[model samples]
Target: MFVRTVYATGDPAELGTAIRALNSEGRDLLEERPGYRGAGVFVDRNLGKLLTVSWWESEQARHNSDEVMRERRTALLAPFAGTLAVENYEVAVFHVLPRPTAHGGLHLIRLEFEPADADQLADAFHATVVPRLEALPGLARAALFLDRERGHGLAGTLFTDHHSLAASRAAQAAARQAGAAKVQMAVVGLEEFEVVHADAHAG
Candidate 1:
């Protein structure tokens, strides 16, 4: 699957209403697009920024729907422009596995790393971490991306809940013990966020 995430910083006063409108627009578009899978909107407690993420069956599908998405997003945020700072991202990797929970919700985790460690981290994640986590229960997906223009390397995972996140971490630790640590290095000076939200596209 392909993942696209957009981050918007909104005035505290207008945040709630803005997020609702944006989420509604996204939901409507996703519902009409065949390749649309799922999505969620998360508000950061500390920064008060909102992150909107969606999954698509392919990059083309996402691109094909861009015009409509742009129009909807513009209309949704017209009233909140002065209160919001918007940015969109094209996800480079999206790996989908299975969620352990039968309840069908999604837990999302995003990590942003320094540019210097991008290559090594990406390699380590794909070669070691990804394979191990992919085997764990509730690990619905994993994706890695390099945003050189923005000096960021992004990695994300989708799970059913805290248990799945814990399991995935444990699996990664085990992989490190098994000699995957050489290529991997702890990511410092990074920003991370964890969010739990309902699957807006759930059938």
Candidate 2:
């Protein structure tokens, strides 16, 4: 599987409007394309940041939609977005305890390292990090996305609610450090968001 992620900065108050646009118009646009699986939108009100992720069955399908996405993004997201960055990744690991829901808490850990270390990082994520995360309360899903060429990756965990998300922070921090050391990757950043919407049509 493959994924495209969009990171944007905008007014916190306008996030709701953006989410609606994404879930309706954006979703409809992507669904019309071949190999489209599903997508979600998350927001960090404190930072006025939003992350949108869409899944595809193959890299070719993902690349094919880039031009259309640029146009749709201009219409749906440009007004609110002060800054926007788009990235593509290979899905290294994906495990769902349950389907995600609105108001779910999302935590993302970003990593950076040499492209040569990509496989090692993926292995460590699957063998070590995922198990620890699965044991946490209210874990709805976890996924790791890696861009080998860019030597960038991010792991995201969605919890059922705020309390469960908060409760797992300490454990997640420890796991993050340990996993990074095991894979010799740098833990570049960590961020949190509220899942405004989520859906998965393909496993």
Best by lDDT: 2
> Between which residue pairs do clashes occur in model 2?
none
Please give, for residues 77-192, the per-residue lDDT of candidate 1 as tens digits: 55544543333444555566544333333334344555676666666777766777677777766666555456454456666665666656656457544423544343333233
TM-score versus the correct structure, for each prediction = 0.59, 0.95
- Best-fitting candidate, measured by TM-score? 2
Residue range 121-172, candidate 2, lDDT tens digits: 9999888898888999899988889999999998999998888999999999
Clashing pairs in 1: 97-140, 100-138
Judged by lDDT against the true structure, how good is candidate 2? 0.87
